[model samples]
Target chain A: MDLLIQIIFGLLTALIIGAAMMVVTVRNIIHAALWLIASFFGVAALYLLLEAEFIAVVQVLVYIGAISILILFAIMLTRHISGEGERLLTRHWWAAAVVALGLFGAVLLPTLAGNAWGIPLPTGPAGTPEPLSGVEELGRGFVSEFLLHFEVAGVLLTVALIGAIVIAFEERSRRRRVLTLAEEHTLNQRQKASAERAAAAADMAD
Target chain B: MRDVIEQIINTTFGWGWPGWAISLIGYLIVAAILFLIAPFQMLFLTLFERRAIARMQDRVGPNRVGPEGAWQPLADGVKIFTKEDIVPDSADRWVHLIAPCVVVAPTMFMFAVVPWGPGMVPVDMNIGLLFFFAISSVSAVGLMMAGWASNNKFALIGAMRAVAQMVSYEIPAVLSLLSIVLITGSLSLVDLIAYQGGLFISSSDVAGVPDLGLGWFIFTPVGFLAFIAFFIAALAEGERTPFDIPEADSEIVAGYMTEYSGMKFGLFYLAQYVLNFLLCAITSVIFFGGWQGPGVGWLYAQAITPANPGGGWIFNVLAGALGVFYFLAKTYGFFFVMVWIRGAYPRLRIDQLMDFGWKFLIPLTLVNIFGATIWVALTKWGAAEGLAIVEGWSPMLRWAVAFVVTLALNLGAYLFLARIFAESQAERLRVDDEVLERLTNVA
Candidate 1:
């Protein structure tokens, strides 16, 4: 079982790294978004390997399902979807490399030195190993123990949503709305009726 | 399944197969069976929909292929297979080739968590419902890829509408299911079914109740509302007619599928019908009690379970057959309703679709969730949960009160929302007319 898990972990790691690289190097903006989704899926699989099923499913649902689709929509709506002829590297590439290397080292050094690796599973009263994360326990913690944090996070998200709507809201008076075919027909009919009435009034005057 | 296989191999045959090997074989067999079942369902559903819809339109549908046109899908499959595969001149070759597989694979994976019969789930994951929906959303990416890779304007428009509709409706769909999850307090499909095993109320809700296999969630007001919303959302998600704007034949020439032909088009068709089947199956499973009908539950109790290993194996077979019968009946019943809807209603405009999903269905489901919470508090809670008023009441009396309260609340909310929504729509129309009149006068 351990061997199987290790093998899966190794494969997932490779997939994550490969997809991440593709995200940066892929010429098409849409393809880069696709690669990003693949990278997100790999992370979700890693979560599953760690026995965090709830988190894994949420990662797929929120990131891959919602966020990546949003990103793709934005990319598609833009002018250059294929990103052909775009420069792969900016002029200050070395500066970016320095920051990237420093961030990677900062993340890796702690993990390499940390003593918390390979911790044993917590046991229940019956001496059986408990799941690393259970859905029910997580729910209980959110509502009871972490109630304030949960509410704050929810409020923050709601605020962000409202802010987005406000920014995107167009003024009704200033907006130029396109009429549907039915509406256009109604407008045309009204104009033709008024025109005929004007002609009839002029004829009566004559 | 692993247990059964181990018993046969290690005990009956005295082969002493290892546990992991037995489990692996069991999973492989289950996966193979599911793969077979998925495509067969797609084939049967295509024929079923055509025949049913044709009957609605007062016409005979392909009755010459086989008896009642049973082999029609097979003939169609052969035609599609023989047709030349075509890729557009400027299409992205690799993405175009891979998109169909991406779309079809998730529908197959969804078979993993669906409970076909009692004790017949493939994986029975703790988060089965969540896993199902999550995997389903992955197909949206595939649709986008298909549209973009095709390099066709109509295909791109169709894909955009498809993704937008799916993303919007999924909110209401998941929210409606959330109410059920809140009431049941579990996401496992099996647990959801097990909770519905009494007369009108669940056996889990009230003890000592008879298991007549009639404890469907639709009997309750909250469940009824959720079922209505979820079914509507399911129609949108499956791209069935009335919500099939994504592929409106009159509009954008088959949507994202406009650029594909031959086997590729066939794959898209298969994915669609398979998805529709799954949506129906899940609807039945969550609301109508999958595999939980008369005589099946009683027989299953007497079968060769771990608790009663000495029981006859005949009961197991009997229970499984009856359970599967009930499940399929409910599922096909839903598919028929989908066809009936397609025949009855014209396709909704895109704006109307969005308005219905966001303004009407989402609010209705949000209120339903509140009712579900109240039901839980009344039926399950006592002084320990700070509901001291319900502490002295009997379970049946509390249940009655909860049902009555929730029914009133839900019905009232529905009527109020409908009135407001109608008024808002009418007001918008009036405003549009006024604007048109003003513009006419200016001219």
Candidate 2:
């Protein structure tokens, strides 16, 4: 079982890294978004391998489902649909590389230096015989131990949502809403009727 | 399944098969069965929808292929297989080729978590409900890929509308299910079914209730509202008519499927019908009693389950047969309702569809969730949880009060929302008419 898990983990790690590379290297923005989604899926699979099924499913649900689609929509609406002839890099590429490398090392060095590289899995408290990360336990902890944090995060998200709507909202007087088919028909009919009435008055005067 | 395989190999044959080997064989067999079942269900659903819709339109469907057109899908399949697969000249070759598989694969994966009968789930993951929705959403990415790869404006528009509709409706769909989850307090599909084993009131909600296998969640007001919202959302998700704006034939020719032909188009068709079938199956399972009809509970109790290994194997077959029968009947019944709806209602315009989903269904489901919480408190909580008012009441009485309160609350909310929504729509039309009059006068 351990061998199988390790093999799977190794494959997933490679997939994640490959997909992440593709996300940056891919010329087409849509293809890059697709690659990013693949990377997200790989990370979700890693979460599953760690027995964090809830988190794994949420990662798929929120990131791949919502965020990736949003990104695709943004790309499609804002940029060229085919995404051809796009430049891959700018003049400051070396600066970006330096910053990226620095961040990666900052994240990696502490774990590499402070802890043993290889270790067996930790067991739960004696006699429990199960992991303490069940969905029910997580829910209880959220409401009890992490209630304040959860609420604050929720409030922050709500604020962001409202801010977005406010930014998007247009005043009724200033907005140029498109006419529906029915409204257009009514306008056309009224124009035709008034034209006929004006022609009739001219005939009577003649 | 592993237990049955192990029993046969190790106990009966004295082969002493390894545990992992048994598990591997079991999963493989189950997977093979599900794969077979998914496509067959898709084939039958296509024929079923055609025939039912034809009957609604006062015409007989294609009955010449086989008895009542049973083999029509097979005939169609042969035609699709023989046709030339067409990809637009400017289309992305790889993405176009891979799009159909991406769309179809998630629907096949969804079969893993659905409970066909008692003790008859594939994985039975603790996060089965979440797993189902998460996997379903992955197909949206496939849809976007298909639209983008085709290099066609209509396909792109169709895909955009499809993704937008799916993302919007999913909120109401998941929120409605969240209420059920709140009430049942479990994400496992099997646990959800098990909770619905009583008379009108679920035994889980009220103790000492009779096990008639009729305590479907739809009996409760919250469940009814959720069922309506979820089923509507499901229609949007499945692209069923009236909500099939993505592929509205009058507007866009086959939507994202415009450039697809031959087996690729057939694959899209298969995925769609299969998704529709799964949606109906889930609706029946969650709102109606899935595999939970009279005689099923009794027979399953006597079956050769792990809890009762000494029981007769014949009871296992009988129970499974009866359970599957009930489940399919409810599912097919829902599918018929889907067809009926397609025949009755005109397709909604895009803006109207969005307005209905975001304004009507989402709010309705949200209120249903609150009602669900109240039902839980009334039926389950006690003085220890600060529900001192309901502490002295009997379970049945409490159940009745909860039912009445929730019913009133839900019904009131529905009527109020409907009026407000109608008035708002009318007001918007009036404003449009006023603007049109002013513009016409000036012209």
Candidate 3:
């Protein structure tokens, strides 16, 4: 059983690394996003191997299900810019490589020496693991022991939501499209006149 | 099925067969069965939808193809298979080729956690409900792939709308299910069903209750709201009428599937019906009890399991048949409702779809979660159970209080949210008209 698990883990790790590499190296932006989903799926598989089924499902739910699709949507929406045969990487490829490698070393060096690198199952698969008792434990942990952190995170997300709405929200009037060139010209003129009026009002008040 | 197979293997063969091997064989059988079931369901549903909708329209459906269009889907399969598989010259050929498979694969994965009868689940995953929804969401990416890769304007537009509609409606779907999860306190589909075993009241809410298999969540206020929200969201997810903006046939020319022909189109059609079937099944599982009906609980209790080996094989057959019958009845009933709605309602516009999902359903489900919490507290919590206020109340009284409170709360939330949604929508349209009038210099 141990050997079987190790084999699966190794395969998943290989998939993760390969997909991550492809995510950066792939020329097609959409393909890169798809590779990112593969990498996310590999991580989810690892979480399942750890018997953290809830986390594994969440990883897939949030990453492959939601985030990857969002990324794909963003990429597809900008298909005019991210057209085929375009170079995704910038000119400073070496700089990015150096930073990436440096970060990898900084993170990987300690992980290679630590207990996490080559550990057997901490507990044999005998008793029902508490975390795997379904979503209740996750909820309890969030609401009780990690209550402070949970509230902080909730507040943080709320702030982010409000911030996103503020930043991304467009004025209602601007969404309407003028049909003819004359109508468009008139709308622009009206906008300029309003801008001038507001400027003048500000100057007079000052 | 796995247990029966393993038992046969253990008895017939020596104990030499490894545990993993037996398990693998069992899973393989389940997968083969599920794959077969998906296509079969697709075939049945296509005919079912056509016949039901046709009847609603005062017309006799396709009865020519082998006894009431029973074999129509087979004819469709042959036709689609023989049709030339055309890929547009400008299309991303690889993505186009893989998109149908991608769409179909998740629907297949969905069968893993669905419980058809007692002990009929392929996988009893701890987070089964989460797994089901998560796997379902993966298909949205495939739909986007179909749209983006097709290189056709209609296809891309269809794909974009598909993804947008899916992602938006998913919020309400999950939120509504979350309320049920909060009440049941379990994400497992079987657990959810087991919780609904009393006569007209959940067994979990009232102790020592007889398991008559009549207790369904839909009878409760929380469940009713959830059922409404979820079915609507399911409509959006399955791209049924009223939420079929993504694939509005008249508008976008088959939407994301425009570029595909032959088995590829057949695959999308198969994926769709399979998804609809699963969604309907899950809706029944969550709101209407999936396999739980009159006598099902009692029958299953007497069925032959390891704990109840004295029970007869006859009981097993009876229980399994009854459970599956109830499950299929509820599921097909939902599908019939889908057909009914399709016949009754016109498709929603894309903007209207988004507005309904985000503005109305999301808020309603969110409020329903609060209602669920209140119900749980009132019914389950006590002084002995760490509550001060409900210390003296009897269990029956507490249940009644919870029911009344939640009913009032849910009704208020629904009416409040509906009014706000309608007003906001009207306001939004008014703004749109104002802007349009200014720009066009015409009414």
Comparing candidate 1 with candidate 3, which one achieves the higher lDDT?
Answer: 1
Clashing pairs in 1: none
lDDT by residue (A56-116, candidate 3, tens digit) is 8889899988888878877765677765566666899899999989999988988887865
Evaluated against the true chain A, what TM-score does chain A of model 1 have? 0.80
Report DockQ per prediction, comma-separated. 0.63, 0.72, 0.36
User: Candidate 2: lDDT of B83?
Assistant: 100
Chain A (alone) TM-scores for all candidate structures: 0.80, 0.81, 0.70
> Higher-lDDT candidate among 1 and 2?
1
Residue pair clashes in candidate 2 = none
- Top DockQ: which candidate number? 2
* Alpha-carbon shift of residue A120 in model 1 (angstroms): 10
Candidate ordering by lDDT (highest first): 1, 2, 3
TM-score evaluated only on chain B, model 3: 0.97
* Model 2 C-alpha lDDT per residue in residues B80-144, reported as the tens digit of each score: 99999888999999999988998999999999999989888899888899999999999999999
lDDT of 3 at A132: 46
